[model samples]
Target: MNARPLPSLNILTGTEVQERLIQARALQAAFKKEWKRLVETIAKTETPFQSIGTHEYAEELAVREVEQETKAIEGKAQRLEEITNGSIASLKKDRQRVGFMRSKSSVLTVGSNLSKDAGLMASLGVWADDFEALWSVQKARAASEALQEQLDKTKEKFKQVGKKYREIKFKNQLLSANIKLVENQCKELEKYRAHETRCKSKTERLEKSKALL
Candidate 1:
């Protein structure tokens, strides 16, 4: 059985979208202006001499006409909204498809490369004709890797120590401030105690003198 080919989808470009948007905006502006003009010409704030061949008043007729115009424009605006949204959604889907294709290609390429390199990695020591030279290179690479690991560990340890030091320094500062506050309070208390003692001694001498008299 023969299958029919699918119909091609038409996509709007950026310019077409912009043009449609401008057209929709122009219609909206015209709708508003037309409504305003009808209000000024046919509809009046006061009761009219004539109702213009209808039982409704002049203002009521104007409102009906404006409502009719609004319905038409509302349909157009809705269609324009649909077109804009559909175009944006289509573009997003196309972008996602392209990204998926690229990732798939990358995965396939990596798989092919890994298959090719698997044998070479297994026979790493025999890759070079000179066994001694290859061994020296491998040794150097191992040493470099070891050094890099050590450096990373040292950096992590230093970071931990530095954070701990900062915490301790902050606590020390708080304790120093507390000690200074307590020292000031102690000095104030000493002054108040000396004053109380002097007042008590004077009162005692005056009482003794008054009792003798």
Candidate 2:
């Protein structure tokens, strides 16, 4: 037998996730409104019947109406549950995608930096070779003021490049540190969201059980 194909998953961005969450919340609010209306109607109808206790057929019809309303409320609650679960799953997937993107970006940045550094080192090697040739010829005329001036200029150029490299390295370190901090914050937020979801699920289950009772 052929295996069934798994459903394709799309990775949402933070903004898309927020929009989806908002839509889900709106749907939940609408369902809750409908459920509440049904509950209130059932309660109002049953109250008058319980007070008089004389109309047998009316009480029977009221009970049937309440049962229908209860079923509808249950259906709404189930839909809301599905929406909540789906939203959470979407958010989790989004978080994973964001983390992957961040990691990929960091790798790319490091690779680019390494390539640039390698090119700079190669240029510096050429400069060193040139300096070596110049120095060998000039060392014999070390007392000459012109040779001293040329040596000083070469040394200054090397110092400037070294300073620039140090600055770039410092910036890379700072960027990496910021990335790590953001990752930690995201993890903490995810934990909090998961905990909130669990609590909400538990509360929903308790409410369902009470409704059944």
User: Highest TM-score among the candidates is held by which one?
Assistant: 1
Q: RMSD to native for every prediction?
A: 43.1, 41.6
Candidate 2 lDDT over 1-213, as tens digits, reads 222333343434445555555655555455445444543443464222132122224335445544454455556555555555554555555556556655655565555677767755755664555455445434433334443454454445434533543554455456556545545555555666666677677777877888899
lDDT of 1 by residue, 149-195 (tens): 54455445434533543554455456556545545545555565566
Lowest lDDT sum, 10 consecutive residues, model 2, at 46-55
TM-score for candidate 2, please give it. Answer: 0.33
TM-score of each: 0.37, 0.33
Stretches > 4 Å off in candidate 2: 1-143
